[model samples]
Target chain A: MTVVGYRRPAPGINPDNNSSAYASTRARAPRHPAIRIEHTLSEITGPHFETGGASAIDLTRGARGEALGERIIVTGRVLDDDGRAIAGALIETWQANAAGRYAHESDQHDAPLDPNFAGAGRIISDSDGAYRLVTIKPGAYPWRNHPNAWRPQHIHFSVFGTGFAARLITQMYFPGDPLLAIDPIFQSVADPDARARLVAALQMDVTVAEYALGYRFDIVLRGRDATPPQE
Target chain B: MKTKLTSSQTVGPFFAPLLRGDLSQMVSAETRGERVVIEGRVLDGNGDPVPDAMIEIWQANAEGRYDHPEDMQEKRLDPAFHGFGRVGTNARGEFTIHTIVPGAVPAQSAQSQAIWQAPHLNLIVFARGLLTRLVTRIYFPGEIANDSDPVLCAVPAGRRATLIAKDIERLAADKAASRRLCFDIVLQGANETVFFDV
Candidate 1:
């Protein structure tokens, strides 16, 4: 029996690993070209995440009280490159608190860490590949990448599609953010259209009345071709 | 396509809290096969340790069968084995996983030729500086079938050693006491590990 392989992303759709603007990539990115290989069972198969337990969808409320920041509702659909829904995919998100401080030991920013905000959440996309996250809007933070370098407010996303090849890790930025133009990490992708896909758009339909604002960010994973390999 | 795929991003330096579950153990006491300990560190081009890296591994069970629907090979599935593990590198850039030695499974290609793959674990590395996850594999040392393994054979001969794990005792110049294999991953530089585009 022969297995069909997932289609590779088009050129410029993915960011270059050796992007120079991101200072860390200088010493970390691979210099040699990646060895191309055909997909085997190992590549086609992935670990299935059980969706039975309660998911950590709401990050605005912790043990103490409501977090300090503007509450926002982020909703999105996980789809394949062919526009098909990728049901039951795991979506993990993490961000800094409203004061641009992470609840991590390594984060030494001169900002207060909200006792009510842990800044992490996880959920499984529904059967229709839809997922919603209720959280506080993250704030911009400063990094030592360059002098006076400030990172734009964004949420880190880790998604697992149907197969191992479909896994993705990306950051979602807000639309109309002036920092988008100057943020090297956001500008790493050479393609304008592909880079725009990383920004989430405001969606009034998902907004709660007198509650949280809403943003929509749809994710696309690599899809398999229609034709299967011959036996 | 209706929408372009989202571009990859670095996992950043703050994912340790999000990944709190114990995913380093892929087997239980009832799990079958030879138990082995895989340990390693994540390094960068300058040979400095990457303290904020996450490693995920997927492989077959003791019977050489995956816990996935795509694997239809006739083999018994271990109820106690999930055949998957995820671990974050410590502050020192070191990580360790306790798993069994997966069995070699039958390889299927477009030509339909019957071939057996050498036992290996598929690994993915996600770190603060890596825009995209790096894909690699871990092949046991002294495996006779490594020469013919389709995936291993595809890698250049000189760079294949990066994929093989070295015995911990051999590195210590002592008699082997336990089944511990060390495989360090160098993202770049002179001894960079081999990464696959698949």
Candidate 2:
């Protein structure tokens, strides 16, 4: 189950969880089977992606106009394990509107819904592996995971790397969110430094003057760099 | 170069809407292949259903050739077969994908130059509690080649069944219209599906 270049995910990340299961994750499953076979040229090679995508990257406005809430810009560069930019990577994001309520039937949280914000966006990384999006800062909403528990403001990200092996789905959190401390999902990663990678940093350069605040998040895919041994 | 790889966080509970919007189906009118329906559920260690999980599949077309430029094989390419599909689990924790039965591809290993791989589908799994996505492959049942598949053979013999999809009779009267296979994903415990690290 040893993945050649995959960094062992820090403890607490659940690639699978359910409503009836224990509130906190149980023991980690045994090593994965995919790691047992050496990757063929097919596994290492990826599908080609183009710059133009169908979905819009601006989530600040929905079908109508500008959504309500503090405006912010999220930008990032996708890189390989060797630090080289991955051009044309497809990035998809979904989150709650400014009120921390998702525009979905399943979300029953009491927060007010934003009619102007659907909270979904997609962008293709440019030649430099850079992609950007503008949206309202999502609010913290309560969840049934724990009593009186509120999920920290965050956006869901799906990064399609150069190859299927490089694909990653994760979340980006705002810095200084107090919910990070008590959230079992965030605290699942045992390493402080690793958890920090999940938080995007405020980037003044990417900020629009007199407009939206900007945050920078860089994502790195697996590459020649060997994965660190499991703790 | 000294910078470490970023850690993975959970995809969480809210991605079903967006995923369903864009990549739900792998087949279209022009797609070429033997049409089939692959269905299954995502279960936790306790055997409880995982309702919010999302699954994606990538595979070769009916001709065993990929839709990518990297696949230099001269096999015919199905312009309609995008070779990818995504679906979210329902209240019953089940998800279904309609795709073709992919043809076998030549082995890449120098030692196995003469051997062709078993027909299979590459998969990625993501759910609320999973910090990162899981990778696995689905092989068709009764394929004698499964015994020799480089990837399938890598798995322990007793546990290999976890990776093979079970052939089922389609309930519909027009059986030839579509084939069916059931493959459940056990996230943990004794019957956990064989996830790959690659």
Q: Which has the greatest lDDT?
A: 1
Task: Point to the candidate with the largest DockQ.
Answer: 1
| lDDT (10s digit) by residue, model 1, range B1-198 | 655688898998999865687889877889999989999999998888989999999999988888888788888988889788999998789999999999997675656676888999999999988888899999999999999998889887999999999987645654453488999999998878999998
Encode model 2's per-residue lDDT on B1-198: one tens digit a residue: 545566666777778655645565678888887887888999887788888888888888999887765566777888787687788888999999988889987665656345678999888888776766777889999998998998888788888899999988766776666788899999888888988766
lDDT of 1 by residue, A24-122 (tens): 889889999899888888888888888653333899878988999999999989998888887888888899999999999999999999999998887
- DockQ, per model, reads 0.64, 0.41
DockQ of 1: 0.64
**How high is the lDDT of residue A204 in model 1?**
89
List the candidate 2 regions with Cα displacement exceeding 4 Å: A1-24, A27-35, A46-50, A54-56, A224-231, B22-24, B107-115, B170-173
Question: Candidate 1 — which residues are off by over 4 angstroms?
Answer: A53-56, A227-231, B170-178
Per-model TM-score (chain A alone):
0.96, 0.82
Candidate 1 docking class: medium
